[model samples]
Target: MIRVKDIITRINSSSISRRMGQGLVWSFTGTALAKFLTLLVGIICAHILQKEAYGEFSMVRSTINMFIVLGSAGLGVTSTKYIAEYREKQADKIPAVYAATNYFGLLMAIITAILILLGAPFIANNILHHPSIVLPVRVGAVLLFFSIINGVQNGALMGFENFKAIAINTLLGSVLESVLTIFGAYYFGVNGAILGFGMGFILIFVTNHLSINKNFSAIHIKKLSIKKLHLKDFSILYTYSLPAALSALLITPSFWLIRSILVRAEGFQELAVFEAADQWKVIILFVPTAFSQIVLPILSSLHKEKTSFVSTLKYNMLIVGVTALLLSVGVMLFGGFIMRLYGATYDNSVPVQILAISTIFSALANVLEMAVYSLGKMWQCFAINIVWALLMVGCSYYLCMRGEGANGLSMAVLISYVVSFLMFLVYTIIVVRKEVK
Candidate 1:
């Protein structure tokens, strides 16, 4: 019924709306593509290697990630927060922040590497129940250096709002990792897969270093003076980031503990099933994880503007809730098909699928948690995350002992999110309400 001119106007308005609506979509798509490539590499490794071999690889990777968290010392996040704040006022200070963060991150990485190398034998024999993992765990320790460097560079790039570079670097690293992993597994077997992962981290480190150097060439390394680094700046950055870092340290190990329990109680086959389900869960998180990255800089900028923090929080919740809901539905519908991609052994049962799909809530909770971090409510975020991690351990132990098997493990994860989400909701409401008044 509308005239052609009116229709054109309406079309233009809709086009604008679509672009706004697709903000999360675009970010998620880029991340999903990168993860898909990485997952394809995983798939090839799974097929080429035996179940025990894949299980061993997974165990070593988890161990490496745990230590890497400590090595990072939360500097990446602290850098992002401080860099975002300082970039507008004293743009010159940005390089100093970068330099200080890199120095600290490297120092922490060395400490963590020493501890990991010393404890590798204990961890392999006791925690993983696989003595063969000792060598690979040591090999993965080398990644800590590269990871620390990459973290600093990524934080700086994110602060600068260089999403295109961030996305490209991630994609290229993932693709290269995939290719190298396939080749490594083909020629070198399980140890080769571990080597390939280390190589991937190295590639990312190099790419990010070059990219950051090219963009900030004029900033000059001579301008970065640790002697000029003020305690006040470090305190502020630590106050804002310490909670999130502690929370990550506390929470990530819970998964490894859960796996340890399963391996000790049930056996490697059960661990294999759990690993397969966990992989899919990680894949589904690719989109939400990417969206969180985009959201962080925006929310940080809004906080700096002294905008209504509650409004920003609500907007983030609304967007994340909707996106999470749609993605959850899709995952639930197609999860079994996706699991079948791993192999017939991993097709799993109905209950396991249902429990795994429940992780959508967990992913949504993560997005909300990030929003809180953006608002500088890291202490509260830390409290909630720790509580969730504890609940996960308790529930997983009880369910596994009660004979729930992989389903119990999945249910434990789901319960942790439910409790954590409720607690976060209460905390957010109380805090935001007080701010409103």
Candidate 2:
């Protein structure tokens, strides 16, 4: 206990420690509220809608989430990285980061929304064979635009370490969205729920954007003026943004592939069951994810100076390791009771158990992935994700087609995540060795 206290004291006294701690505190508050609301919204909709209708709702919300990631083009990450780096060394370039994020994120958001709107028909009818969801898909696309802009706002704010604003914005948006979703689902059913859920993005983006802009005077018309944004500025911003975007592009689509496999192979019921169980996985990842968000900007700065970050990384990994151990055991024990909460229909705990087991691998993968991101190994990270996504889709497709149903899909994903975790761990070790020497 004394040794642990000393180590804690040392960590708290470090330069980046306050920033990381504040980030975690604020991020955890916001994340807890947002995810709790999400869980509530899921329960409300599950109670309100039919099983099939609830499944469609989950699918649409998931799709909008994926599309926003694609549309933002990893500019959020790029902005965070460059802003932190520039703030430390070249303050003059900070404006360019802000300018590029505002204009470029908006452009990408618009394009992404349009694509989702236009592609809705083809996706619902041709690919998904769920024509009734066509209009709902379009409705959800509204969130895509707002979500990207929120990403832009939050990215810059994160770089600036404005957690108070981020926390407030995230919590309010989620609360409003949850409130609206409950009302809408009760009055309007599945489609209304989809559109109402999108409202959260709108609320969060607008409020957060305003807060950030005020905090940093981020939208300086002078710096953003057409003449000031030289080609070099664009080149620099795009150069960093592109790799991150490519990584998101490669990764986000896998969500749809996973959903589509369950939908086509079995039916909406299977998808709903998997979705419910998967929410547990979200719970397991949430805290580590919050830590990762806080660490990224700090890591970005440290990496810029070529400082040794292995200690920080180790501490972060240690937190997740203990969490993984406890959660893995808890899930093994309480898997059935958890599924029971989703109502009487979700009786089978097998999928939940499988996903619970997978969370251990997923948690480790997440930490390693963040380490690589901190090292600015986006290209190497992208290669691993490409392989992971390919393996996931191909194996999931084959297994689902084997008529083994959602169980098989779960097993396939479990195996794939395990393999990916091993690869990421090995990759991070090798990279850290080279960096150390």
Candidate 3:
């Protein structure tokens, strides 16, 4: 065993190790609080709403989430990368970058709104096969504007390493959403749940907007004029961002396709099982989501310095792997009990239980994906995501057609995640090796 003095000396040698440990603690606390509140809200919704309604809600939310990626246009990520680089150079271009990108975000939001309005009916009727979803889908479309702006502001904050602000925004949004959703759903049912989600974003957007304005008073509206925007600068942003945007669109929307297939082939009950399992998986994902939020900006800064990418990758992998292992064990052990919190009916399905357990692999993959993104390997990430999405869609279709029910779908999910994780691992190894050499 190592002596206490030796351990203390080792820890003192690396400032990064110390900072990372602190970041992890803060991140874990914020994530846990946010996820807990969200999970509680989900539990309330699951108990109050019928499984069919819950499944429908999940489908609609997933569809709207897909559009969020478009509204974001990967600018948030690109902003973080560039802002971190600029800060290191101690350049005064920060205000200009912010001004330009905010305008870009607005433009993207406008275009997204138009696309949503034009395609709302078709998406609801044909794609989701639920014309009833049209109204909520349209309402959620308004959120695209809010989401885009929020992304930009949050990206900038992350670049400055303002984790406290980020944490506040996240926690506040989640808490407000949870309280509003629970009370709303209790009174007005499923539509209330949807409304609460919309309202939550609106509140977050307003709060963040105010905070940003106060913090970055130098970045005035006049500074954000389109006339001052440089096409060359915009091109640089797009060059870095397009892959991330494409990857998000390809990967995220595929969930809806799987949901649609399940609805058509297995009916609402099986869909409900799938959604239940997926909810638990989302809870497990909060760990990685929080980690990514903190890691990306740090990695972006380090990358600009031409640091040891291999060591960074190894460190990230170790932390993520250990976290994933603990979460997996916890989730697997408590999955049945967790399901019971949703409702007695949710605990009936063994396959759903198994699916929730499989989230371990998915969570690990998500963490590794974040590592890849940090290295600015968005093209590789995009390619791998597309391949995985295609495979998931195919597997989902085949399983649904075969009438294996929710269990079959779960198996497909497990296989898809395993494949994606392995692919990400191989790609990460190659990229890290190249960077080191």
Q: How many backbone overlaps does candidate 2 show?
A: 1
Runs of candidate 2 with Cα error greater than 4 angstroms are 1-10, 217-223, 304-308
Q: After TM-score superposition, what is the CA distance of residue 414 in candidate 3 from its true location, in Å?
A: 2.0
What is the per-residue lDDT of model 3 for residues 1-437, given as tens digits with 9 covering 90 to 100?
42545444444565655555656676667657887887777777877777877776667677767777778778787777767667656546666677767787888888997788778899888876778878777866776667767787787777666666666777788888888778767887766776777666766687767666655554332235577666775774666778988886877678777878888897776777777777767776667666666667666666643444444545555555666667766767776776677677776555555665566667667767766787778888888998888888899889889997777777777788889989988887677667633
Q: Candidate 1, residue 241: CA error in Å?
A: 3.2
Estimate, for each residue in 1-437, the C-alpha lDDT of model 1 and write its tens digit. Answer: 32444433442453322432454554555556778887787777788876778878877887777777766766777677666666666677677677777777778888888778788899999777789888888887776678666776787777665666677777777777788778878888877888787776788887877777765664343336677787754664478656757886887788888878777777767777777777767766666666666566555655643333444455455555666667666767877886677787777755336554665677667666766666678888888888888888998889889877777888888888888888877776665555433
Summing lDDT over every window of 10 consecutive residues in candidate 3, give the lowest-scoring window.
Answer: 215-224
Which pairs of residues collide in model 3?
none
Best-performing candidate as measured by TM-score: 2
The candidate 1 region of ten consecutive residues with least summed lDDT is 11-20
In order of appearance, the predictions have TM-scores of 0.88, 0.93, 0.89
For residue 137, model 3's alpha carbon misses the true position, in angstroms, by 1.7
Tell me how far the alpha carbon of residue 246 in candidate 1 is from the true structure, in angstroms, after superposition.
0.9
Q: Tell me how candidate 3 scores on lDDT.
A: 0.71
Q: Model-by-model lDDT, in order?
A: 0.71, 0.80, 0.71
Supply the TM-score for candidate 3: 0.89
- Can you write out model 2's per-residue Cα lDDT over 1-437, one digit (the tens) per residue? 22545445556667767778788898887878899889878877888996899999998888888888888888887777777777756767888778877788889899988998999999899888899999889998877788888888888888877787888888998898998898889999888898788888888878886776675565342346655787777774556677778878877779687888889989889999888888887877777677778777777777633333665666677777678768777876898898888889988888878877887788878888877776778888888888888888888898889886777777777887898899999999899778643
Mark the regions of model 1 whose C-alpha exceeds 4 Å error after superposition: 1-30, 214-223, 304-311, 435-437
lDDT of 2: 0.80
